[model samples]
Target: MNELVLTLGWLGIYAPMALGAASSAIGCAIAGQASIGAMTETEGGYGRFIGVSAFPSTMVIYGIVIMFTLNRDVTPENAGGLFGIGILSGIALMYCGIWQGRACAAAINATKEKPEIFGLSLAPAAIIEGFGVFAFVFALVISAGIS
Candidate 1:
């Protein structure tokens, strides 16, 4: 139905931001809990723990940007493209955020034991972030051709 299509189009337009926020919230919470635990064990380097916990927040920003980019008149013609790209990219970003959080938590736990490996420990999280970037870029590029 045309109404269903337009409704889905609207859902797609907002899905990225909503999903991304959920992703960031879960990711940040996971890393933040580890950071808190680590902080209690260590005497210093509190800043880095807090910083690492915030890494997952980037997904929400990406989502917001993608939402804006996808914004337009939601008609049956473009609704399917919007839904597919928005939902798929949102899922990718969400996956990245959640996994990145776990990675950051791992890094925090490891670095708490061996402070010298701080930089190296972050590699996994950075790599996860890269995957999110790829999704973001793909959405942007593909959405441009939608209508």
Candidate 2:
């Protein structure tokens, strides 16, 4: 069982980056689709739409950072903590990325209709990003105590 636990510990160490990449891909795709549609409809403000679509990519960066932070010797003593924190934080990042993408898509659509409200439309996506930040910060904080 020690081997199994160590294996899980390794899995946990890398899970954040893997899951965060997946999240970024899904989120970017969703927002990209919306941006593409908006671009075809509106001639101006294509840059903003495209820019917004990239917002979800931050999750991967967060994941990479978390993965680095979590990197260390995996022993039975701390494996459980590593697994729990890494996996849970990864899930949180994934959730945030996916929802943030949808939010960005919504913002794009809204801005497409009323360009004046472009800034306001991004509020939801920003809020979602804030949650991701919270997860990232907390993960770092918690991981510091794991050892």
* Most TM-score-accurate candidate: 1
**What's the TM-score of each model vs. the native?**
0.99, 0.98
lDDT of 2 by residue, 1-147 (tens): 999999989888998899999999999999999999999899798999999999999999999999999999999999999999899999999999999999999999999989999999999999999999999999999999988
lDDT of 2: 0.95
The global C-alpha lDDT for each of the candidates, from Candidate 1 onward, is 0.96, 0.95
Clashing pairs in 1: none
Q: Write the per-residue lDDT of candidate 1 for residues 30-134, one digit (tens) a residue.
A: 999999999999999999999999999999999999999999999899999999988999999999999999999999999999999999999999999999999
Number of the top lDDT candidate: 1
